[model samples]
Target: MKQKKPNILFIMTDQLRGDCLGIAGHPDVKTPYLDTLAAKGVLFSNAYSACPSCIPARAALHTGMLPEHHRRVGYQDGIAWRYEHTLAGELSRAGYYTQCVGKMHVHPLRNYLGFHNVELHDGYLHYARYGSVPYRESQHVADDYYYWLKEQKGISADPMESGLDCNSWVARPFPYEEKYHPTNWVTDRSIDFLRRRDPDQPFFLMASYLRPHPPFDAPAYYFDLYKDKKLTPPYVGDWEDTKLLKERGRIFDSLTGPEDEELIRQAQIGYYACITHLDHQIGRLLMALTEHELQNDTMIFFTADHGEELCDHHHFRKSLPYQGSIHIPLIISGNPELTGFAPHSVCDEVTELCDIMPTLLDIAGADIPDRVDGKSLLAFADGEGREYLHGEHSYGELSNHYIVTKKDKFCWFSTSGTEHYFVLEEDPHELHDRIEDPACRERIAYLRNCLIRELTGRPEGFTDGTSLIAGREYPVYLAEK
Candidate 1:
């Protein structure tokens, strides 16, 4: 008999940083559930987002192509990009039940962007105020919690705010709610799908969670978990001095001040608290999986769309390619017999978000298409090596590009027209910018050339490698096909 094709359960979070989880060696943040998941699976220590914002990142994940190639470069209007292919399309083609619950972020077609069915709950909110859809009104955010919040006295709240109560940790506007929380809804639906699913046929379920993003708010109890505990904020370098600063007119800047370390500290606390809240929900999902005896047959992956600034570099939002804005956690959990093939392994190689599609295809015994610009992690997890990885962020707020190897990293700000170079092993915090270093200039040029190549989809020695972000237009490679 042929080997059984594993069910694919991709649990993707939004705006979660790489260091937010305990499995990533964070000293403070509590992520016991994720740590447990990591123990049973492979952890990619150097996993980077393909694009640092929501829409572009989601596009990359679905298409297995870079942001520029897939088009949906920014969260603007309709489905602007003519996608080559998507994992959902592939899995559906292979006769798998491809289902997407929660945010898939594809525009034009609201239902089933290649998936057989999609329970879309607040995906790519292009119309609502502050990028928020009416989570409560849509029956996506949880009605009981909204009622409870409205009934609470001495809290001083707004009904509009009550409607906005989706779970997230990044400091902003609302608090986490379990009833209508995106994580809870997505997980609940996933569990339901699993229970009702045809056991004979394999399933491909993408459970997307919208939390640990912004408007950092969770249940007051989760806040209490870190209320007394001190949370460390990201190091604030000479933010004003560096051109690498966030694009001018960024929103979160008004919330911070020169001597507002305590304020920043509170913000960090709120952020981590939100992450912990999401982790708790993840624990619930995992428990359900085990209770249903679905853990072994399911190849589960936990990762995020992108990282939030969380007051890093004096910026609070995402859409930048800095480590704080691009690096994210990637944990793959599944059968111990298969995981034992490389037990408790860590792959430090640079891998892009696009790589996820190929990996999933490999796991499902499907052939990977040629247009996808990523590689499978089969070798990397088994202690093999990979070359450089790249990420893109063309959101209006931040124009950024990045490429990384295990040792060196180069980040560019297309909005500011500045380049940053850092040796990761030497200065992990990226405190020192080596772009101007005499010995590093040659390497910087090489990396910049590579960025142009990757972004333009041209070969290395192409002198006419144009840049849309930098105002030089050769043949504008439109994001759409």
Candidate 2:
């Protein structure tokens, strides 16, 4: 008999930094299980989120399209997702049963898009929480995780009882039992899906977790693991304006600002705790897969929507053009019996979340859509990848654009017309900006012209004939699409 096609397990996390894993050489964060998986497969060391925010990043992932193509250039809530082709939809058409266990972040709260079934758990979204239009249905209906939490704990049980803002830098241990945490709940439902899935047909399961993103509420043991360890301080760039420290310091959810040392450490502890907790749950999922004798027939892909700044360059969140905000981890592993499987390898190609859909479809022997902007990473595992990646986000007054290659990066601030360049080979942490270096002036001009070409025809009119115009309010979503 012909061999059955391999199962696909696409694991995703929210706001997880690229370098926080032990395999990525993180000094303090411990991700032993993820490291082991990386050792057994191919790890894309230079993966990035083009838009570096929740909504746009996920748009790129689902549609295999660029931010510009998808028309979600920045963070916008309550917009209807009207895409015709999606990763799950295409896979379902290819004879696979696709199911999403965690966050989908699709509008309408129940927009399954292409997934046969989606048990959503989108963490604290202001648009849905405030009973905004188009999301009023969400306000009336609780997510699967929230309803389950109410059943496990009382109706008043909340993850915020620990006194931490969902998106703020505050930190604390979870107020309830470890199993009652959302991370474990996500894993629990995922395992239950595995136990109850249709066994005759191959399955495509997306185990998406929403932790290490906010509330920073890991259980006590996980939090205690990092509370007393000497931690690395956030990098402070020489060109960063310290004035931002004072200007936005007191704002609870300000994107960029200086935070006290103790508070930063506490936040780091909580963040790392959440990662470890998530890692442990991932271990459980892997064990369950093995217990079901599905390990050798399953292809697993692990990644995140984007990275967190975590006070890097005095920035506390994503949506910046820095490595801390855009860079993310991508690891793909599967049975050695699988075709094109590269064991114990690291691919240093420039990859993005957009590549996910095509890559998975490629593995499943399905046809890739003609309109996708992303190429299949499976074909580039041992070969060259994109020459450079363009990333941008509309951050109200701080809208920005960036172009990044393997060795360097160029950033442009649309509000102030300021330029910043960094040589990644010499300064991977982006401690120094070299835009003023005479030796690099020509390269800077080249990158600036590239950025101009990218934005020249956009609806915002961010670029004129030759130069980028400043002070224009960039729209969250393009109107002319």
Candidate 3:
């Protein structure tokens, strides 16, 4: 008999910081399911997102390319990987039934990139006129947290009224409805899909969860989970200190002033709750798999698009290159035969979002394109992951870039000409800035110069290639407009 191909369950959560998981050594949060998952599978201890935002980060995961190559660029802009062959497309070609349920974050909200079977349950908050195109058109019909404020909560507070004080885009809450809460609804749909899936041929199912992201709202019960847990976070940094930062670092300053601590604590609480909620859903999905007897043959991989700030360094959201935002959990469970080399192993090697595609393809016995920027770690099952991981974010008016090596980190501000250097071994929180420290000037120079060369060498003015189709597809909506 021929060797059986393994099915893959790729689970992703939005804005879940690295320390949020119990397996990741988080002190407060309760993540029994994830902890159990990590115990059975290999956990990439230092897996980081290539970019800190949604579209670009997710784009990298699906396409096996970098943001510089994909050209999806920012939040508002969407990169069309319509032309490249995605992991889904590759698996589909290899006779696997690829299905995507819940937030894929594909642009136009209608264009199906590669997965022939797709159901867009929810996605990031879209503020444009295209808002009408999301799962819910008006906030009236759906009650996201924002909606809860306007209706159920009867809170008429705007960003300023709510004591957000700053002009930050993330200050204000949005409408919310428990009925459409993406996490719950998404899992509900996924369970339905798994229940109805035919078990004959191998299947590739990605049940992406959009939680622990923002609006920090879940069912009231979830919020109550962390009510008693003391809000203990990593060392909080001085926001007013931005010597190397080019701009005012509006986000940094946003963490100061009254109500800041409370707001941040609440956000943390909500974020933790969101995480636990997702874990419960994971348990459900795994149970369904077990019930269907798909657990043995399926290769389950759990990760996230990027991590949330969760008040880390006084930052409320992603878009920063800090370890808090970039580092995410990567757990691969089941398929004990394949896990032999890395069974229950915790690899601290640096890996990027781009590596996910090639890894999936290699395991599925599909052809991985040579143009992919990420290397497959399947080879490292017995070896080790890379020593460095790169991440960048050029969204909004700020241009922040980072390169993380085994021992050192180099950060650059495009507008300020200011550079940041931190020896990761000594300064884990990245609180101490050694940009001007002469002792490590050579190391900084070496890393900065290397990163500059990499950034400059990217195919400027064009997005990276995807595995979906043959050529690259540029942004048609905003670029044309």
Q: Estimate each model's TM-score.
A: 0.83, 0.97, 0.82
Best by TM-score: 2
* Candidate 3 stretches greater than 4 Å from native: 1-3, 127-180, 238-259, 458-481
lDDT of 3: 0.67
Candidate 1 ranges beyond 4 A from true positions: 1-3, 80-84, 123-177, 238-259, 336-341, 382-386, 395-398, 455-469, 473-481
> What would the per-residue lDDT of candidate 3 be over residues 177-273, giving only the tens digit for each residue?
4554557666666777777776677788898887776555556677777876787864555432533222323343442211345655666676777
lDDT of 1: 0.68
**Prediction RMSDs, each to the true structure:** 5.1, 1.6, 6.9
TM-score of 1: 0.83
Kindly indicate the candidate among 1 and 3 with the higher TM-score. 1
Tens digits of lDDT, candidate 1, 90-200: 888877898877766554335366788777655324243234444433322322223333455324223335443222222433443456455566777778887887778
* TM-score (C-alpha, index-matched) for candidate 2: 0.97
Count of clashes, each model: 11, 0, 26
Pick the lDDT winner.
Answer: 2
